[model samples]
Each structure stands twice: as C-alpha cells, then as structure tokens.
Target: MQINPPGTVQEQRPDALTKYLQHRLAQRDREGNLRRLPQPTTGIDFWSNDYLGLAAGAAATGEGTALPCGATGSRLLSGNSQQALDLESFLAAHHNQEAALLFNSGYDANLGLLSVLPNRHTVVLYDEYCHASMLDGIRLSPVKQAFRFRHNSAEDLEQKLRRYAQPGTPVLIALESVYSMEGSIAPLAAITGLAARYGAAVVVDEAHATGIFGAGGTGLVQQLGLEQQVTARVHTFGKALGCHGAAITGSRLLIDYLVNFARSFIYTTALPAQAIDAIARAYRYIGEQPALVVQLHDLVSYFRQQLQERGLRGWCDSITPIQSLLTGGNAATRSLAGRLRSQGISVSAVLSPTVPLGRERLRICLHAFNTRGEIDLLLNLLSSCPNPDL
Candidate 1:
C-alpha cells in the first residue's frame, strides 16, 4: 500500500456523505436557520432558563468538593451508590410520588421512559408543543399509534382521546408543565382531568417548571395538586434548579420497570456524585429561600406591565419566567437578537425548525436576579425598533 511520507500529511477530500451533509448545512445557512453553539458573552443574562438564578450558586457549591468526578458505570453496574438512592428517595417525597428514578438528563429520562413504557398495544397522545425530548421519545417508542393535540388545548386533546381511546388499548398522554418555545403553562388540571375520564395514564415533563412552581420547588403537578392523577412526572435539575441530571417520579412499579427495561438508563453511566450533591444542595437552597420564586414572578409581572405600558404586542401570555416576542420571520428574529447582543443585552432568537416557520420569535427569559432597570433597557431598545410586530 502506498502511504504518505513521514513528514507530510495526505490531503483529504469530501466524500459523498460529507458532501450531502455540507449541502444540508449550506441550505440551513442560506435559510438563516443554522444553529451554532453560543459563544461566551459578557452581556445581561436574559436568554437562559435559570429562572430562580440558582445555577451559579448550586454549581459553585459543588466545586472543590471531595466527591467523585465521574461515575464508573451504569447504575445497574458499578456506578450505583447510596447517595443516588438517597436523592431519589428525597425527590419522591418532595414531589409526592411513591418512587423516583434518576437519569443523566431530562432527555435521557424522557427517552428511557417513553421508548420502553408503551408497547404495541399502547397509543400516545401528546401536546403539539411538547419539548423535543418528549417528541423524540415518542418517536422511538413502539406504540401502535401516536397523535398530537393542540398546545394546551383540552378540547383538542379530548377529541384525540375520544378518537383513539379504544377498549383493550392503553392510552398514554404526554405533556409539559411549561412549553419551552411558547413559554405557556400547560393546563395540567384540565389535561389530567381528561386523562382520568378517558382512563389514560398521563406523563408530564416538568423540566421547565421544576424549581419554580410548587411548594419547595417541587413542580406544577404538585402545585395544581394533580400528583395523584398524573401517572409520571419528569423533573430536571438543569433548568430552574441550576444543576444537571433529571428524575422521573411515579409509582414503585414504574421505577422498577424503568430500572429493568429503560435502555437509556441501563446503558449510560450514572451521574457523578458531585452532580447529585449539587442537585441536593439546589433543592435545599430553594426550600430555604422562598423569596426566589416570588421575585421571579414579580419580575415577570413587571415585564408584562412594561410591555403593555410601552404598547408592545405579540408577546406570549406566559406567567412563567419564559417570555416570547413573536418576530414572525427567521431573518427578523435573528436580526433582533443580534441587535440586542450588540447592546450587551443577549436574548435568544428561536427559529424554525425549533418552532413553526411563521412563528419564529425572540425568547426572553426572566430571572429572579434580573432587575427592573434591565427590563426597562430591553423594552426601551424594542420600543426604538420600528418593527410593526412589536
């Protein structure tokens, strides 16, 4: 075989697969919808999901600890530890569940739960605006049928349930406590009521609502007192709790089933002791400081009041920290975000296919630590723009 000289490297050219990938990326770029990892910027924090401003403190507390940096194997193997078990116990009690099982992340939790829980006899009915992880999980599941209901629409969900809820077929209803893009809270009470009537099991992904909604930051399922109705709830520590990893709260039977059959949890290494400690600390912190949630709600209210005062429209009616300004087009949304970034006010321009093509918008997340002045500045900048959408 001929080889390159020791001092020289051979030139590499794009293969067919590489060329196809390049074409796809080029198309995305041309459409102004190419996504890039955000560079670190020293700007006012207005885009992240840190609603209670807990990420930094929780992570900082975990730093310099004597805990292990890595888990050696999956929980079923050498990675299992007492700390993990204890944390799960705490989570179960805190969330008013009979049991809890930890997964590496919210995506892992959803994937492991949805993919294996529903067999060929089950049908999945999900909200149209559910998170990507939930959708992906359902896509990978072996369910005989899956259908989407309109976002937070109990009537549409009822229609689907009526159509699909048949004898001998188990129905699974999937929901999010809070939709990521629209920032709208799911009508959990209504949705759960529907599930009860249809004899369906409800699974809620409370990734965005965890650590900001209920008593002691449990979740909206608990806040609405619908814990008894929901079949399972996935709470993630990465968002409001400002830590990593996620847990699914349900019956002991559900947890046991996941332990035995969930591929994502069975195959992946468990989270490190440090991350578990961080999550523990975050829960304790939130429990001790009740003002964080109040402050966050206050900020959201103030922002909304300012929006109305400034005659700015096209905002999503989200009571949570997530607030969206509908900019309508990919280019316009990106331009608005870029303009904010230039002024040291960083926000996210959520574009399709993250959202529908015509529903592109700027996602502005409010934090407990964000001040009224910062809100004013952001609104002032928007007021200066001549976009009719605003």
Candidate 2:
C-alpha cells in the first residue's frame, strides 16, 4: 500500500502521493470496483427505470428536442408555466387529490414535504429502508424529534406510535409504497389504518409504484382506495412515467400551505412548459393504453418465476420490477456486476453507504419492453456466475 503526504499536488515532486492514489485505484480495479462513465452505446438495456420503454419512444422524440435541456431556473421564480398548472390539474384528478404541486424531482418533493410540513412540534416516523431523499428531508426538518421502525412492519410502527403519540404534536408517518432497492411492497392499508387509529398523518412516497400499480397507474394509494386516508402522497414521473418532475398530492389547503411555507417549493423556479407537457402526454398515453400496466405485471411475474425455476429465488425478495441480489462485500458485488455487464446486461452494483456496509448487491430492474427470452438469458447468466451470493 502507498501513502500520500499532505499538500502534495499532481505537478509537485511527491512520489508518496502518486503511489497512494495509485494503490487505491489498483485496489478498486482488482475488486472490479473501479467505476468509469460508460462510452454511450446502443445495447441491450436492463439498467434504466424506463419500465414502459416510453422514454425512448416516438412520443419523446423531436427535432431540436435538446434545446431546452436545462430547467434554467427554479419553480417559484422564472420556472412557472401553463404546462405546470395543466399537469397539476391532471395529476389532482388522476389521483383524486384536492391539489398537486410539482417539484424538480422526487428528492426535491420529499425534501420540501418532510422538511417543511413537520414543524417543531411534529414527530416523524419513517421506514428504516426508505430512500435517502426522505431521510435527508427528515434531517433537514426543523423538527428534531424523529425515529425509524422496521421496514414495512405495521406492528413495529404501531409500537412506535404508542410510545411517541402526543395530543397536539403532529405525527407524520413516512414510507414508500414500493421499496426501490428491494422491490417489496409496503403495507399501505394496514399502515394507513394504524395512522387513523393513532390520529397520525401519513405520507406515502409512490415513486416506484407510479405508472405501474393502480388503475391508470395512479399509484398504490389509489390501488388500495386509501387516497383520503393518507395525508400526502409523492409521485415522480421519471421512472415508470418516462418523464421528469415529481408532485406532492394532498388537500388544497396542504398545497396552499406548501406554497406559502415550504421553502423548497417557494424559492425554486418551476419546471418548463415542455417538461410539463411531456408529463401530460405521458399520463394521456397511460390512460389510453391500460394494457401497458398489465404487460408490466406479467413481465414481473415471468421474471420472478424464471428466478424460482433456476433455484435463485433466495438471491432476491422482490415482486416488483426492482430485483436485488445481496452480495455482501462491495468487492464481490462489483465483480458480479462487471461480469454481467460484460455479458451485455446493464445491471448495477448498489454499494455502501447507499445500503448498509455488508449488504451491497446487484440491482436488476425489469421493464415491460424486456422480452421473456431476455429474462431467461439473464437468469441463466446469474445461475452460471462463479459467485452465487449475488
């Protein structure tokens, strides 16, 4: 191993510094962990979250499409547009919410909601395995009082509520409808029922479930008929919708409160007209073609069945499109991902600090456009891998 002395610059005469960086780089390379930006190429794509394959379709294609590539400004200031209002109206009606306020991304939506909605007197109980964005939002929150229960354990949530429930303090329960990394579904109905019992408001992040779960792909809340039960629901168009931007759906009063008090929503410029138009078009497409969702469910079932048949069911625990294989060490996980990529699969290695230190693994995303043959080929490759831990 090499050590780099302090204050050593690349042009300076420091053999130790050069050796130190070189050694670290070599370690990563040896473990198949050295990451590089891929030279863009057309290939069998299994890595993207475009589950319906709409992003690459003719709908999203246009000449000079890249002109308005950047958002330019935040939503509150120069970013406001008619398209944003139109999308909000469409989303509000689609999800049966009073109002919908759009944000830059799912992360921003969560941050705006969690950090601002919970005041000093509020208590936030979040799922242990919730996405980093939600955690980050909670951290930014003015409310210092927060705790996490076991992931998707309604009993654990009830226990926490019993301990933390107060008369005047607002108890906000944050959980995702579908865990992005594990692909496990959350017990939305049970959780909502518990919240009702305890008088706590519920916030459900439907990033993964949007455009794939409910009728017309509204989300898990709509699927379970608990839209009115939950206090707030966050939906992102980036994944299954094949568009960018996220929205927080709740009462018109809540929307008004966020507009006036949520700093992230107030200070930022809105999304452009084109982006909003794209989301509207995506929703229209979703409404017209209900078969896409059915196809996606079928594909997910087919892929899971293939895994079970190959005796690799133990490697994953997901029924949704996001399947993960837990290969404990970062080194092993990266190696397996590299091997899969070389075989022309686009699976990615989820490494630490994204997950716990020893839980790093390969994240495989399934899409409606992916054929049964591709699923079989990928599973066969997985079965043949020298490291089956992944």
Candidate 3:
C-alpha cells in the first residue's frame, strides 16, 4: 500500500471535521434542539430529582462536618464497607426482600441486573416505555430474545407471553412500577398473576415509586403487597428518597448471582461511604416521618385539582409527581420551557430522542417541599399560554 511521506499530513484537514461538527451544533441551536448544561442556580427549584428536598437539607449543613464528594472503589473490592452493607440490609428488610445489592446509580443497577442475570435460555419481556437504562441493559444481555408489550397492558403482556413462552426457557417480565415520563402506575398484581400462570419471573423497576409509594417508601411492590411475587425489584434512592444510588432487591441467591456475575457491578467503582450513609439516613428519615408521604399525596391531589380547574387537565393522565404538558414540536416545547423559566419556574423540556419526535413536552416534577403558592403560580402561567393542540 502507498503511504504518506514522513512528517507529511493527510489531505483531509482536522479543521474541516471541527467545522462540520460546529455546523451541526449551529443547526441544532437554530432548531431549538441544542442542549446546554446549566450552572447550579438559586431559583424556584422544580427541575431537580430532589423530591423531598433532602439533597439540600440540613445533613450537609452541620458545623465542622464535611461530606465526602465521591466513592473511590468498586463494591466487590474495598468499597464493600460497613455503611454500604448496612444500607443494603436496611433496604432488604424495609422492602421485605431476602437480600438487596446496591449499585452506583439507578442506571447502573438496571444495567447490572438486566445485562448479567438473564442467561442465554432466558427471554426478557419489557414494557414499551421502560427507561433507557433498562433498554441498554437488555441490549447488552446475551439473551437474544427480548420483546416489548404495551405500557401497563397486562393483556398485551399475556398475549406476548403466550406467543413466546416455551418449556425450559426462563421468561423474565421487566417493567417499571411507575413510569418516569408518563407518571402512570403499573398493574403489578395483575402482571405478577399472569407471570405466575406462564412460569415467568417479574422484575419491577421502582426508581420513581421508591420513597414515594408503599409503607415507609419501600416501593410500589411493597405498596401492593406483591413483593414476594416479584423476582427482582430495583429500588432507586435518587428520586423520592432524596439520595443517590440504587439497589436490586430479591432473593439471597439472586443477589449472590449478581454480585458474582454482573459486569456493571464487578467492573465499576462502588458508591462512597458518605453516599451509603446518606441512603441509610434517608431511609431512616422516611421511616420516622410517615406524614411526609401523606403531605406529598395531598399536594399531588391539590395540583391535579388546580390543573382540572384551569382546564389543563387534558395535558396528562397522571396523579404522580411527574406531570407532562405535551407541546408537540421541539421548538414550541423549548419556547414554553423558556417562558416558564423566565417566570422563575424550572421545568424540563422533554425533547425528541429522550421522548419520541412530535411527542415533546414539558416534564414538571412536584415535590413535598414545593408550596401551594408555587403550584398555583405554575398553573396560572400555563393557563395564560396559548393551548397547543393535544
């Protein structure tokens, strides 16, 4: 093969590549689809995942005490500290599971569980609207057979199972207890019953439901008393628990399998001691304050009522913290989000790719810490805006 002379560069210039990328970025900006990382600011905090306002709480404000910023090692190694173990145990007991294994984040937990646990003879049946992490995990799995059913449609799921269920093939039904974008609850009991009939195992991702549903925020499975039916339940602490990290709750054998075989768990650095401590603290806080959950439910009801009164009830069919106002196009959604931000509100514009094109909307998350006045203000702002066609 012919080769370039020593010290001679290729005809294709690096600047050309840079210019092309810049052009694409400029196009995105023109289309109102360019995403920018915003610096942390003091605003009417509504965009964050801090559902209970514990992230900004007094735990970080104690005199002469500083929280560690990060975790330095993986859980399989030196990271398997006492704090982490205690938190895992606490979660297991609280959720009524035989064991619990913590991961770096909800994403990692999903990745670890879905990717590693399912064998070649296993088939995964996931919800159509399951989170990205779960989808990614399934993609990484060796199990060649994975199918999706309509969101929360037990009948649809049953049909899919009937089509694919076979002897000696383990069927794992993967779904979320509470969908993140839609804010709708899953039919856990019905799904579990069907799974039992089909000899399938159920895996529930309780990222959104944890710390907001069930007794002491154990999760939706616990709320519905179907903990024993679910083979694996992923509980995330980032949302309502007001902390970081996630755990896969199941039988002790399942935990052992994941601990030994999950690449995402085995290859990654573990959560820090402080993060583990925070998780423990958050669980304790939730257990000690049952009234917080009551307050949150009351607030959600009030918000829904206000939405109905303002004639904006058609925006979403959610009674949960996540409420979407479908604005259709990316440009319109971005414009609406900007306008809300200008009014000192923080709502995220769920754009194309994060959601499907033409289904872009604003994702408004409610918090127990958010006042009634803030909710009213949000509704009042929405009421004034020209209604985009549903």
23 in model 1: Cα distance from truth in Å? 48
Candidate 1: C-alpha lDDT: 0.81
lDDT per residue (tens digit) for residues 3-42 in model 3: 1222221122222212333454567668885443222234
Off by over 4 Å in 1: 1-65
Cα lDDT, model 1, residue 222? 79
Better of 1 and 2 by lDDT: 1
lDDT of 1 by residue, 321-362 (tens): 999999989999989899999999989999999998899999
Q: Model 2 compared with the native: what TM-score?
A: 0.81
Per-prediction TM-score to the true structure, in the order listed: 0.83, 0.81, 0.81
Error of 1 at 227 (Å): 0.6
Task: Looking at model 2, report the run of 10 residues with the lowest lDDT sum.
Answer: 6-15
Whole-model alpha-carbon lDDT for candidate 3: 0.78
| CA lDDT, every model vs. true structure | 0.81, 0.77, 0.78
What lDDT tens digits, residue by residue, belong to model 2 across residues 1-390?
122221122121122222333444567578885533123234575654445544433244443443243333444433445556767877887888778899988998998888877766778999999999999889998787899999899999999999998765678899999999888999988999998787788889999999988877888788777776777899999999998989998776567666655677776656655677788889889989998888888998898777777767446577899988888889988888898899999998999998989778889898889999998888888888787562
- In candidate 3, position 328 carries an lDDT of 85
